[model samples]
Target: MEKIFTLFLFLPIFALAQKESIWDLEELYKTPKYEETDLVNKKGVKSIFYESIDYKGKPTKVYAYYNIPTTERPENGYPAIVLVHGGGGTAFEDWVKIWNKRGYVAISMDLEGHLPSKNHQDRKNFEGSGPSRHGVFHDNNEALQDQWYYQAVAQVILAHSFLRGLPEVDTNNIGITGVSWGGMLTSSIAGIDDRFKFAIPIYGCGFLNGTDGLMGQHFKNGNQAYRDNLLTNFEAEAFLPKATMPILFINGSNDAHFPIPAMMSSAKAPKSKTYLYVEDGLGHGHPPAWDVEESYRFANAIIHNLPLMDIQKTTWDHSKMDFSAVVKGVRPRKVTAYYTFDKGKWQKRRWNSTPGNIKGTKVNAPIPEEATAAYLIIRDVKGMSLTTEVIFDTSDKQTMK
Candidate 1:
């Protein structure tokens, strides 16, 4: 292989020409600058204030809810996870509590420079709306440091560092997950920050403007110059290739906020090992679409070195779809194939499924003539299930399934 090299200004020797990084993470962490204050302890967790810098070099403080297990933990410490909420979401205490119940130390922080307080539901929440200044998107021509993404991604990494520093957290077992816009940030963070061993990004992947989804349309609303600037710099595609950890892309098959094709693009663009958890007719938001069982299952596999049931390969022809997977750890009672002819506007689509022919861990199914997309589902005897991303027959020129 040929080695590529580059020359830096004022340096005589040529250095390896590595992929250009959108984020100067080293510079962001250079000062170790942040302030922490303890807040009220509630629901088996301790909330606190995690202060850091914004894009404008101003001192900014965001709220976080963190908790250590009350019960006995492993000798080293408990596995920890940092949760970044989507747009309009604050530092939800409930998110922390959910993980605490799962025997993991957890932290949730507000990225919008909001104080984690109480929400309309009266749960401990962040006080601000959206992000600090220009919300999620800002001027593309501005210096990257002064953009919303720079601060948001930095804040997430800083939170990871903060959680790792806690005595009760097992740094080696740390992971990160997020929803919606937070999911997008999670993808970028996974690419830039190699400290996280695993990441789960729900309903948010990058390369938005490339898809025909709402976000792409949203980008089109901006001037072409700004759109081009964003596509070149802040989009997840630019950073995901650098991801060194395992990532699971979980989302609805028909998400209104993020299109399936766009999600696929982000998942495929990354160089890291990727997993999928796409559901039929799954819509946006956390409740019905967020599969906590699968997320924890994947996390446990990573943290404990347990056997994992995962898709090794999937291929589709015009009439048949085939699946190959490693199921060494699980004894599935049933394997099913799901398919849908409905395309576009995932929220309004309906999906149907049928029993798949499972020869050990290999699954084969007949694709309906009208089917546009299909996915495989393996259900263990214990009722736990794992899924694959929507598979399409790219060989066919027609768009309709």
Candidate 2:
């Protein structure tokens, strides 16, 4: 009886230890000690190595490229952003320069522990680097602290902490954007780190196990223990609900990796304001992903307290085959509905667009009878676009709503 009582008393302590072992937020929140380096010699950008969570009981360092705009700093310090690169990408000087030109202090970090190079495969690992990414959940069996996902997330949070300490950064206005795998990280981080003013994840979302993409296949085929650990401790779905900041999800309708359903699931997971910008025929890559104007506008709006284009709700009339949504915020120059009749894989489907009839704040378009899936796109005066969630017709009849 005494042993049983003692076991119950220690259960809470064991649970607490397991929680902390996933990520010690208190430690990661502190400004990480960093060292600046001259390895990158861009005109305005500088490279640095910052301390990260230890891997396998050894210290690790994260490489990053950072810069601030040449313009005079605002009295409250410049709005800042942290750029996370996708698969096979490193901290890019051009990426830092892009945001620097936009009048913000920016930092782009290499989560793979490699120095910046033109070729991803040739990028050399620096001393004291953490474990490199092998696959999404390939290293699940390893110690929690030593896993790639944990290390990557810790490095990103550490970057935010390091950036927040900068004298020229507006700590309250800092935002984060990540492409591809980086987008996946951004999604998860959005929930784990609430200090961010906003988060933009391009071509990334949670609910990986349900999609038809390779990542989803991996999750489906993975062992039960591996799947459990990833879903509970690492995936974005687990963290997005805790996010308090607004999130902008960007993706292509035919993205081979993150499909529309998974993206929608991610957008809905966050309790905070969520916006979608899934474009038809939009290709996936680091350069193309960052080229979206809506991402920049979204960040700018949030930082400057400007209003963003909001779609209140989407409605459909089965008899007329008409789709409509009430639009608010910034008035759009044009609105269009893109639909696809192809049924099997989202990646192989051909999309067709029809102009919407805009009447006041509401826009309406007719979806063809053969269309299996359709979504609305609203383009602003600046040519930037935001989209409503996709509605599907599962049967031969029009069941869109």
- Which candidate wins on lDDT? 2
Candidate whose TM-score is highest: 2
TM-score of 1: 0.83
Give the per-residue lDDT of model 2 (tens digit) for 286-329. Answer: 98987898889999889999877888768656457888888888
Displacement of residue 191 (Cα, Å) in model 1 is: 0.4
lDDT of 1 at 199: 94
lDDT of 1 by residue, 1-401 (tens): 22111111111111222376666667554434444455544566666766566545556656778888666899889999989888777777788878888888988877766655556234343432224636446556567776777778877887887877788888899999999988888987887888898999998887666455566566757477776666566677667877888888888766777766666666766677787777666657655534557788788878988766656556555423343344545666677788777655445557788887777766666767566567777776556667755565443322211
Per-candidate RMSD, Å: 8.0, 9.0
Q: Which stretches in model 2 have alpha-carbon errors above 4 Å?
A: 1-21, 381-383, 396-401
Query: Cα lDDT of all candidates, in order?
Result: 0.68, 0.82
Candidate 1: list runs displaced more than 4 Å: 1-24, 27-43, 117-142, 289-291, 317-331, 380-384, 393-401
